[model samples]
Every structure is written in structure tokens, then in C-alpha cells.
Target: MPRPLENLRVVDFTHALAGPYATNVLAQLGAEVIKVESPHGDLFRAYGDDRELAKLGMGIPFVGSNAGKKSVSLDLKKEEAREIVRKLIAESDIVVENMRPGTIKRLGFSYEVCKELRPDIIYCSISGYGQEGPMRDYPAIDNVVQATSGMMMVSGSEEDPPIRVGVPAADTYTATMAALAILAATTQRARFGTGQFIDVAMMDASLIFMYGSTAQYAATGAEHKRTGNMGFSGQPTSGLFRCSDGHLVSLGVVQHNQWVTFCKAAKREDLLEDPRFNTIYDRIDNAPALVEIIEQLFLTKTGEEWERQLSLGGVPCGMIRTVSEAMELEQVKQRNLRVPLNIPGMPNADLGVLGTGFLFAEDGPAVDGPPPFLSENGEEILSMLGYSNQQIADFLASGILQPSKKPETAK
Candidate 1:
């Protein structure tokens, strides 16, 4: 009946998306993740509320990344709060943080501090860059990282300036990587009885994604230009086509033989025989004409029809479904991807669009807790640590264990 990470305790000092995301994955697999937050709380709660106290707990991002964890509000600047966090560390097996490079050490609670408290502690730091890179100190968001890592430059249409992805992809990807690394390190610790400090960089993950084109461009001295919907593999027929219903389907005829199947499916056998569309290079050169032809052909059917044909023919293709559609798909439903999350005191709490990406494939307990109210458990937590009610009341009065209250109450 035990989960993969049953009984393991985690001290989560992460916010926004990346660091919290990693620990949330651990929480899903049965670790106890205590999320320590500043007094005002993670900035994302305001992302939905626009700074009003009534709007404080509205966290679309926070809900997605922080489900199945306990939230504790503590101003680490205060010595009282820091001491409480130290107590939590004494009972924790993992500690995750996503502050700027030196913020934790400056707060007087570095990896060394945690290691001294718990020798087998696994400490993870997820930042824009690794802890010691020349660019480590620079604060970065997902779009900024994309631009700096050259992902934006190669991600757009040829006619437009570099465009950041519509989603915070770098943050999400790096967070997934961080989770994998933490799991790997935890696995190693089972044998060695030693844990390590893991440093994950968002920019580094972006660069790795661009490695293929970046490496080719480096050796060839040629810049890789954007080809709109055209994929980088130089597939002549790999582009999005609009159906009569105003929907799109990504058709990738990457293989020469797939091209024949695609042409036959589209009822365009003459294009196959046409010398202008014979080879991959020729198809790339004649993509404009090819697109025109395909567009005209696609207008005769709907996106659903093309998806069926493409799927049946074993051609590489995907229908451009909306987020709702994607969420409702059979595969997604089967995977239990859209987990129902109910946070405490929220009207309707559901925290998962970009849920845990590190799937184990084995049937197991998923992350299953409502996001905690800020410092809601402080008194209980301290009591569990042997602090009496009077000690807890003193800490509460001093604002050491700050807990959020109803909107009409004090600040």
C-alpha cells in the first residue's frame, strides 16, 4: 500500500513554476512537501487578483504547479521564521529552492546549513542559470531565457521578429528536468546514503532544445531560418494546412514514401509525378506551390477527415486541437492527466493545466492535496516539533508564523 516516495519529507522553498513544479511531482508520488512562502505569499496569487486581498488566493499558476503540497507563510528575513524553517529541515529529506543564485545563502540557510541539519538531505536549486555560471546572477523569465538562448530567433516565421512562445515553455521544461534529476539523486541516495545539491538552469534547458540546429549552424556557418509551419527536418510536406472548418492539421510527410501516401490521400498523385516535387530539397524549394495546392485540396474536407486519413495511412500528422479538446482526449483521460484539485478555502479550486510531467507509467498514487492556505498549519507544525501552545502563540504574535486570514481581516 506504500507509494514510491512514502514517508519522505520535503522542504519546498520554491515559487512561480519551475522549482515548485519539481517538488509537486515528488508530492504526487507520496512525499510530504512543505512549501515555505514569504508573508505576502507567492507572486502568482496576485496574477489573478491584481493585488486586492479579496483576490489574493486566486492562483492559476500556483494551483497548477503547487497542488498536493502544504503552504506555510514565513518571512525568512525574520530570525523566528528562519528558526522554524530550520526545524522543518531537521525532519525533511529534500529541500528545493528557486531563488536568485545567492539568496538562500544570504538568508543564512544554504545547502551547507541543511546538510548540517540533515546529512542525507537532497537540496535542489532551480534558477535561470546554474548556481555558478557567469550568467548565474541574472534574473530571467521564460521569454527572456528564450530570447537569450536563441530559441526565439529560430522559433518564428521568416517575416516576423523573433517571437517568444505563447506559453512559458522553458520554465516548464526545466522544471520537468529538475524533477527527473531529483528523482535520480534520490535513487542514488538509497544506495550511497548521501545526497547532493542539484542546480538546474532554465536557459541551459532552452539551449539544449536548440542543439540540433545550433550545432548544424555552427559547423556549416549558415543560419537556420524559420520556415513558418515547416519543420526543421526539411520535410517538404510538413506544414499546417487549414481545413474547410477553419481548423488546422500538422502534416509531416518526412519520409519519401510518406509523401506518396500523403499525395494519394490528398488526391494529388500528379504532384508526385511532377518533377518539381520529386525530392526533399525540391519540395522545400517548391513549398509555396505545394502549400497552395494542399490548401486548395484541404478546403474540400474537414480537419477531422484529414486526421482520420493521416492516422489510418500511418503518416505523421496531428490535428491542431484546442486546449479543451486536448484535455478531453482519450489518451489524456486515460493517463489521468487532468487531475481534479481542490485547494482549501477557494470557491472552486482546480490546479492543473500543466500538471506533473514526470510520469512513472506504473499505476501509483498521484499528487492529491489541495494547495495549503498560507501558514495554515503553523501552530500544528510547531506543536509536532514539540513547541507548546504558549510558544506557538508568541511566534504567531511576533509574526514568525504568519497566517493568511479572510479578506475583511487585518493585513
Candidate 2:
């Protein structure tokens, strides 16, 4: 099967989550992605609390987003290393970097430089703010961007301290959007024979995720309040409820039909005739009383039983599940959400990571191979650029290609 981006080559100069995630998407779609790292490798390789893995320079976070790409360590601070990168960019279709604004330019591979090398190169820059903004140079990570973008304010209850999302939503979404932009640019290049620069800001992407709330605030001139586990529609039945087993179930009875179905399923058909609960708006207005009654009824059954009955009765509901439980779900297996990776030097040969979000009928997204060790393909990449074995050795000796010091057991 011929993948969509099979012919494309990408020079990836990204670290941490956001930039790597975008390149990962490209790699999954069959682009030949060469990930350029510094002599110390990507800082993400030291992220997380697993000290043992961090020592080996392969943190879980790094492995999660870096699969299916070749790694080549080069000290961009050196002129010789910069020359190597220029050569790599000249031969590639796209270049993606997530450094702070002006960092890549200082290293001498800005959009203008790349365009001079490759006439139709797609250069993407991912940053905290943007290239030309007041906060362009500010250092930001997922949590900081989440707070600055009003995401934390809307995440938890109003009484709770501003809670950051458990997952790096800002970084992940920004990466996804970057991939989309890059793909769009690729299409444009094909059509017009020209390349362009893409500036994707994590702050902008975070705001996109909050578009619904933003729209509401714009129209009503009132701020949207934090309502934990409650649907934004203010539906009385669309929230979490505790069952007899003390476990919780999320019920999403947003539509009138679902509300009526829920009422019948819980043997509370009298709710349909009650004036305060007659219409969706009426139910919203009397949500407190309605929720109290529903909670009492829900406490009569276990969460699993309520899930079974409500789901069968056409009401949208599911039992709250832990991360482990969710991963082990039958649906997850059926959808092929988890994929096996055989990373070199890792203790586990068959490590599981997430698969692409969606599938294609032909030539779909797939993890071509495991994540590379730091500079794992340094020699191979240099050779592809027409360097002789002696030249490759000299480059390695000059600290231009810093390969990983693999454990004896891995060798």
C-alpha cells in the first residue's frame, strides 16, 4: 500500500511534546522523518519520574511521541553541524522546529535560509506565543499555556483552585493542528510550486479548543462558569451520578428523547408529566430538584447495572473507568488503539503505545518501526548525504554525531 506522504522527506528539529507530536503524525503517515537532536539529545528523554529509564536517555514521554523516525544528533551551535542541517533541509520536503522564537534563526536555519536551500520547502515553527508578539519569547510548557489560555479556569469546579488538565492538552492539540497545517501546505506546494512558513502557537491552539465557551461569552457578555463533569448545555440529566456500589456513571441525556428514555429506564415516568421537568428548558431551570431525584433513583442500582439498563434503553451513559481499565477495554482492542513497539535497548521488546487516531482503507497510518535511540541512525543518515566512511568517522570524532552509549546488555 502506498501511503499519502511516502515520497515526502522531513527534517525534524523538534524537542519535547508539541513539535515531536507533529512530526510523529507525519512519520505515521509514511514521511521519511529524520529527527535532529543536540549532543545531549532531546530534553524530553529526561522527562517523567522514571529515573532508571531517564539514565538510559529514553523517558516514557519521549518514546510515546518519537516512534517511527530516525534520530541524528548534531550540535546546531557548531558551524559544521549547521552545514549538515542545511544539507539535510535541502534534500527534504518539510522542516519542523519547536524552539523559542528566534532560536532557529540564531542557529542560521530560519525560513528564509531553508527556502534558499529548498525552493519548495514547508517550514513550520511551533512556539509558545508567535513569531511577532509581545509574549513571543516567553518560555511556556503545557501547564503554563493551559493557564494563560483560560483552559485551567474552565476545567474544574468554580470553588476549586484553577486545575490544569491531567494530560498535556495544549501541547497535543497544538501538535495536531501543526500537522494539519503542514499537510495543507504540502497540498498548496503541489498545486502552486511554492512553499510557505507555518507559525503554530500553543496559546492559539488552546483558544481553539475553548471556542465554544469563547463564542458563548462573546454573545452573552457573561463568563462561562466551571461545572465539573457537567455538560455545557446545562442539561439536568447530563452529569455524573453515584450508584449503590459507590461507583459513578456519566449520563448524557441531553436531547428530549434521551431524557424521556432515561425517565422510563429509571421507572420515574412521573417526571415526564411534572410541570418543572416537562421541557428541556424547564428541567434546566429546576435542575437542582431534578438532579436530587435522579441521584436518589441512581443509588438504587449498581453502576454496572445502571450502565447496562440505561444503554439498552437508548440513554447515553457509561461507568467511570480508570486509565488502566480504559486501556483494557474491548473497544480499544477492536479499534487497534494500542500498538506494539520493539524499541532497541528497552527492557520490554513489545512496548505498547497509541496508534493513529483514525484509520484509512488503504495505505493508512502505522508505526513503521520503534523509536530510535539518540543518534541511532547518525551513520546511515550521513552516508545517505554522500559522506564517506572516513568522513563519517571524522564527524563522529569531532562531536558532530553523538550516538547513544547503549548499555552492554542492549548491544
Candidate 3:
């Protein structure tokens, strides 16, 4: 099967998580992404827990997101480098950047300049706020965006202090949203025969993940109170419960029939007939009493037993698992969501790295190669742009073009 974006070329000027991850998605979809890096490389190259990997500038975090791309390091301040980039953009289909607003313009490769180079170039700029906001120039990361977007407020229990999510929710979601918007723009280009300029803001994309509570607040003028582990339904039966084994089991018994089934499955049909717990409202009113009864019932069975019984009995239930436990699940392994990558310098054994969040039936998402070393393909990329061997060497010697230096670990 033919890959979807196999014929497309992308000039990626993104550095950190959101921008890089966004173009990484396009790369997995088969775009030939040429990652434009500065001399020192992306800051994320020094991020992650592995000391050796960090030393090599192939930190786990960077490795996870940057597979399937060629790297070209250039000092944009130099006219020679800017000329090379202009040549690249002229031959590319898409251009993406995550710099502060107006920064790219100062670097001489703004949307106007790129559009001049390639009339139908789809240019996307991912920023903290957007191109035209008061806070547009403000710096933002995952936690900061979470705090500003009101996402942190709705994450923890009402009594607890606001808690940013453990993962880089803002970066991850924003990247996904940007990739989606880029694909949508491609579709639009197909119809209109003109490229589009996409502006994606981390704050705006963060709110999309909170659409449920955001819409509710908009419709009713009521703020959402954080309910901790409770399901969105707010049903007494739909929350995390401790099982006999001291493990937590989430029960999603929202529908009336599911509640009835839950009660029957637990051998506590008395809950069904209890006046204080008969209806959804009644249960809400007597939540403490209902929760106490359910808690005691759940404590009588191990998490596995409860999962098996409740799930087989048509009640939505599952044991809460740690990341390692979740990854070890047979179902997860069968799904092949994570792909094994042969990262150079790690070891002979294949290293497992994350792929696209979704799958395609025909030519599914896949990486063409491992995450690049800094300017790993600079010489080759320059050659492709019609630069001769002498010109490339001269540029490299003059510090206009930085060449790749494989880490000592790889040697």
C-alpha cells in the first residue's frame, strides 16, 4: 500500500515538543520532513532521564518524537544559511514553525517570504497564544499552558490545590490538533488549489480537551467542580473503588440498566430496592450511603474477580493500572500501538518507541528511520538542493552549514 504523504516534502522549523511532535506525525504519515535545527540543536535533545542518551543528544524524550526525519543545522542569522532555507522551502510542500510570534519574520522566513518562494506552500505556525494576541509573545510549556488554560483547575478534587496533569497534556494535545489542522488544510488545498496559513495556539487547543466542562459552563454559567476519580456522568456508581486486593477498580455504571446489573453482579440487589438509592437523583442525594455500601461490596472481591464478574455481567468495569501494567496488557501488545525502533548507539536490541496514536488499514503510520543526530543529513540535503561538493564544504567550513557529528556512544 502507498503511504498517504509519501510524495509530500516538509520543511520543519519546529524545535520543542509540540512543534516537533506535530511534524513527527506528518513524518509518520510519510512526508519527507527536513528538520531545521540551530547549531546547538533542540533543547529537548538534553531532556529525559537517561544520562548517556542525554550526553549523546538522543535523549529518550527527543527519540520518542523525532523518528523518520532528516536534520539540517543552519545558523539562520547568516545570509548563506537563509539562502539555503529559501531554496528548501521553494521545493517543499509544507512549512511548520513553533517559534515565538514575529521571531521567524526576524529570521527572514516568515509566511509571506515562504509563500513568495512557493505559492501553494501550506505554512503552519504553532505558538503559545497565537499570532495576534496580547500574550502571543509569552513563552509557554506544558505545565504553564495547563495552568493558563483552566485545565489544571478541573483536574484535581475541589478540595485539593490545582494540579497539572502528569503527562505533557498541553504539548501532546496541541501537537495532535496542529497535525489535524494541517491535514484539514491539505484537504482544503485539494479543493481550492491554494495553500493555507494555519495558526495553532496551545491555550486554544488545551480547551478542546475540556470541551465537555467548557460547554457546560457556557450553557449554564456554572463552573465545573473537580470530582477527582469520578466519571463525567457524576453517578454514584461511576467512580474508582478499592477492591479486596487493595487495587482500584473504576466502575462506569451510569445507565440505569448498568446500575441494576452492577447491583445484581455484586450480589447486592438490596441497593436496587433501597429507596435512597433507587433513582439517579436519589443516589446523588444519598451518595455517602450508596458509596459506603458499594465500597464494602467491592472490598469483598479482588480486583481481578470484580473486573471479570462486572465486565462479564454487562457492567463497565476495569482495574486501574500503572503505566507499566497497562503496557504489559495482552490487548495492548496485540494492538501494536508502539513500534520497535532500531535506534543507533543504544544497543543491538530493538528499542520500543511510540508511533502515531491511530492506525490505518492500508499503509499505516511508520517511521522511515531513527531520530536523527544533529544535522545528520545536512550534506545529503544540501546536495539535493543542487549545491556542489565544494559549495557544501565551504559552507560547512564557514559555519554557515553545520555538519553532523555522531555521538561518541555510537562510535
Candidate 4:
């Protein structure tokens, strides 16, 4: 089965999380993504403390986000390497970069240069702020963007210190948004017969993700408060509760009907007649009392038991699960969210990575292969560009192209 973006060619000049993640999405959708890296390679290759994997040129962080793409290592500081990149841009349909505002332009491959090479190329630049802004040059990563976007303020309890989200929410969301913008630009180019330049800022993407709370704040001129483990509705029953087995279950009794159903399921139908818990407003007003009662009732059953009963009764609820446990779920397996790929040069031949979030009836998103070793495809890429054997060797010897080192065999 043919993939959606099989015909598209991408010259990916991205590194670290945000940029690489966006190109990964494009690669999963079947685009030919050529990931160009600097002489030292993407910093993410040495992000974590896995020295063993790093020695093998397969750091977990790098492998997780960079599968299904070819790697081409080039020292952009060298004129010869810059010429090779220009040649690549001339043949590609899209170019993506996530560097400081003026860095790419200084490298001589800015939007203007790419447009001159490929008139209909889609050029996307992801950054901390934007191309033209006061803070455009400010350095930022996921945690910094989270703090600046007020995301840290809205997480955890109001009394707790501001906490960064456990996952790299800013980077991940920015990548997702960048991919969406790139696709939109592709569509626009198809219709208008001209390419476009896209500017995606991590801070801007984080703010967009908080649109609901921002809208409320704008309309009421009041700030949204942090409510730990609770829904924005603030219903007494819509939060995490500890069960008898010491596990937690998250309940989301939003609608009036769901509240009534939850009461019946937990044998707390008496709550229906109580004046303080009768209406949504009353429940919100007397959430403390109602929560105390629900906590006692939940303590009577294990989290799994309550999950079964509540789901059977049509109340939205789920048991809190660890990452490993969540992945082991039968439903998740059925969705094929985790897939195995045989990555070359790695000890584990059948390692698994996540698949695309959605499925298609036919050929959909897929991991084409394991993440490439640094410049694993450099020779082949240059050859395809009409470079002769001697020229390719010269490029390698001059440090214009650095190929992956062969894995050492056991002594």
C-alpha cells in the first residue's frame, strides 16, 4: 500500500527534539526525509547517560525520535559542504530547520536561497520565539518555554511550587504544530503554484495549547487556578481518588447524568437527594464535603474494581497506570501503537518504537527503518547527486562528510 506523502522529498536540517520530531512525523507519513547534521552530529545523540548506546552511535533519545530517515553529516562551516547542501535543496520539495533566527541565513541557505533553488519549496523554521521578535534570539528548550508560557503556573496544586511537566510538552507540541503547518503549506503550494515560508515558535505553540484557559482569562479578566488531578469543570467527583488497594483512579463525572450514574455505581445514590450535591453549581460550591464522601466510598474498592464498575455504569473513569503498564494494555496492543523495527548496528535487532497516532484502512504511517548512524547514507546521497567516486572520497578525507564508524566487534 502506498503512503500519503510518498512523492514528497524533504531536506531536513533539524536537530534535538522539536525539529527532529517534526521531520519524524513527515518520515512516518512516507516522505523521503534526509536529515542533515553538523560535523559533531545532533546533540541529542549524547543527551542521556547511556554511554554504552552512545558509543554504538545509537543513543536512546536519538533512536526514539529519528527513525525512518537518512542521516547526512556535513560541516556547514565549509564552503564545499554548503555547496552540497544547495544541490540537495535544488532537488528537494521542502526544507525544515530549527536553529537560531539568523543562523541558517548566515550558513547561506536561508528561505531566500532555498526559494532561488526550488521555487515551490516549502520552508519551515522552528525557533524559540520567531524570526522577527524581541526574544527571537533568546535561547530556550522545553522547560524554559513551559515556564515562559505560563504552563508551569497552571500545573500542580496552587500551593505547590511551579513544576515543569514530566514530558517535553513544549517540544512535542511545537513539533506537532510545525508538521501541521508544513502540511498546510504543501496544500497551499499545490493550489497556488508557489511555496511559502513558515515560522513556528515554541512559546506560541504552547500558548495555543492553552487556548481554553487563555480564553476564559481574557473574557473574565480572572486567572485560571491550578486544580491538581481535577478537570477544568472543578466538579467534586471529577478528580483522582485513592482506592482501598492503594492505587489511584481518575473520575470525570462532568454531566449531571454522569454524576447520577456514578452515584448509583458506587452505591452512593443518597448523594442525589442531598441539597449540597443536587446541581452542578451546588456541587462546585460544596466540593470539599462531596469529595470527602466520594473518597470514603472509593476507599471501599480497588482502583481496578471501581474502574470496571464506573465504566460499566457509563461514567468516564480510568485507573492510573504507569508508562510500562499502559503500553502493555490489550487495547493499546490491538491499536498497534508499538511496532518493532530491525535497526542496523544496534544490539537489539527487533527493537520497538511508537507508530503513528492514528491508523488507516490501508497503508498509513509506518517506521520505514531504524534511525541511521551518523552520515550512514552520505556516500550514496552524494553519488545520487552525480559526485564521482574520487570526489566522494575527497569530501570524506577533507572532513566535508563524516561517515558512520563501523561498530567494533567483541575481542
What lDDT does each candidate get?
0.80, 0.89, 0.90, 0.89
Task: Highest TM-score: give the candidate number.
Answer: 3
Candidate 3, pairs of clashing residues:
none
Tens-place lDDT digits, model 4, residues 1-411: 689789899999998899999989999999999989987888887765667777777777888889989989999999999999999999999999999999999999999999999999999999999899789899999999999999888888889999888999999999999999998998898888989999999999998888867878878989888888899888888899999999999999988999889888878888899999889999999989988998998999999999999899888999999999999999999999988877654565567878868998988899998888788889999998999999999999999999765454311
**Superior by TM-score: candidate 1 or candidate 2:** 2
Q: lDDT by residue for model 3 over 89-147, one digit each (tens)?
A: 99999999999999999999999999999999999999999999689889998999999
Looking at candidate 1, the ten consecutive residues that score lowest on lDDT are 402-411
Query: Can you tell me which runs of candidate 1 are displaced by over 4 Å?
Result: 49-54, 215-222, 267-276, 285-289, 349-354, 357-362, 404-411
Which residue pairs does candidate 2 place in steric collision? none
**TM-score for each of the candidates:** 0.89, 0.96, 0.96, 0.96
Alpha-carbon RMSD to native, per candidate: 3.1, 1.6, 1.6, 1.9
Task: For candidate 1, write residues 127-204 as lDDT tens digits.
Answer: 998899689899998889988988887776889898888888888788888888889989999988998999889987
Give the CA lDDT, 0 to 100, for residue 164 in model 3. Answer: 81
Q: What is the Cα root-mean-square deviation between model 2 and the actual structure?
A: 1.6
lDDT of 2: 0.89
For residues 322-392, what per-residue lDDT tens digits would candidate 2 score against the true structure? 99999899988888888887766566556777877998987899999877778888889989998899988
Candidate 2 weakest ten by summed lDDT: 343-352
